[model samples]
Target: MTDSYDRVAVVTGADSGIGKATAVLLAEHGFDVGITYHEDEEGAWETAALVREAGKAAAVRRHDLTDPVRAAHVVDELAGELGGIGVLVNNAGTGSSEPLLGMDYERWRSVLSVDLDGPFLCAQRAARRMATEGRGGRIVNVTSVHEEYPRVGAGPYCAAKGGLKLLSRVLALELAVYGITVNTVAPGEIATPMTGQEDRVPRAGSRPGYPIPRPGDAREVAAVIAFIASPAASYMTGSSVFVDGGMVTMGPQAAGALQSGDWR
Candidate 1:
């Protein structure tokens, strides 16, 4: 309420991992933050405490983005609580390890709804508010290296992220006139709670598949997202900033070069 220009960011799935890192980093950069979590209210408050420790205000909420309709409404609710939304990071996502052919219909629908439809709803709702209020916004979708590369058992995740990447570009083109910038951040092999590797930081000898020779930290990816959400990115939109340690560029040759998997 201090100024219409006061920066406020809403990051979904912020209870842990990359989303948590993003909220904390944005706070460090002087943005009031709103964090949403599906079931980990405690983790959400932990993130809030980190934000407060960084000298910024934080609003925490319980959100399930699987419902597109409810997803938009949640954006509206968060905006109301945070004064206005300057940045929206659609980071809530889920993955399926089930094989593509054997995947059930409901399971497939669930993935698409959360990863694609939900972001679409939130983007539409937030962009409308930003354009209408005459305050442009920043939307950074947390996609994956899978947005460009297909994995063995992650067909649904690949499809959803790929769709979101294209959708983000379209939104970037459409929202540019309003001064709103939209972009995608594709991270590869990040060390986050999602990978069940929070206790193990990426070591110099690990992650042989990466050119950098190690998995990235969540903060590493969050830094890229924070930059894109900042005013310095005023002229950049419809872009995909990759934080994949050269994973995607390595191509099939990289996977083919992999010497082993646990089963092997």
Candidate 2:
């Protein structure tokens, strides 16, 4: 059946991938969940149904979080509906793959607005409500390993995630006095709709450069988020935990070793 926590959580981009996983996991952990979707009402309902099946309340809203004002309002409405926001998971972000020199102003700004500004607005609104509630809260950002590393064609995404890393740190420090904790979960390659890999992974033919031999599961990342939102993680704040399966720690030569000629 469904587990139940007294806390309420707001998970943005709950239609698919990591966001959906987080929302369902939070429901299983007993938190009444508020989910936001950009244009996928069907997916949102599916997520809400999962929460209900888990025996918790679920609220779904539509939002395009690039507009900071509207995004903030969305958080406000969700908080009002859910009674109060106890956990805010900033997982609503998009990515673009373009070289710095090839990127136009609009593309860069779009990535930053969604990845960084959206989180700022949502966190601000949620934290305000959380402070008024007189109880502690949790804000977990679903960042990426690219926040610290570099990818060839994803300069804009990397920059935005890097900024998000610092944003989480700053918010954690400023909101600590209010009894709130802020942290980030940087995930590696996970099998999800976003990654275009659903149930099974194709690995028979090549099996190239992965030291772990397979991508991570979305539920695994959700487990980390669930822990951060729980009371057990009260002492942790402003920290970034990499769940990338040693991908980030691998050296330049590591990928080569997996290749036949030691070069990709």
lDDT of each residue in 1-264, candidate 2, tens digit only: 011223999999998888898999999988999999998899999999999999999999998976867877998888888887889999988888667888899888988899998999899998888777767799999999988988887888898899999999999999888789999999988888777788344343232445565687778788999999998888899999998777776766675456475231
C-alpha lDDT of residue 189 in model 1? 87
Best by TM-score: 1
Local distance difference test, candidate 2:
0.85
Expressed as tens digits, the lDDT of each residue in 21-44 for candidate 1 is 999999999999999999999999
RMSD of each: 2.8, 3.7
Name every residue pair that clashes in candidate 1.
none
TM-score of each: 0.94, 0.91
Q: Each candidate's lDDT (Cα)?
A: 0.88, 0.85
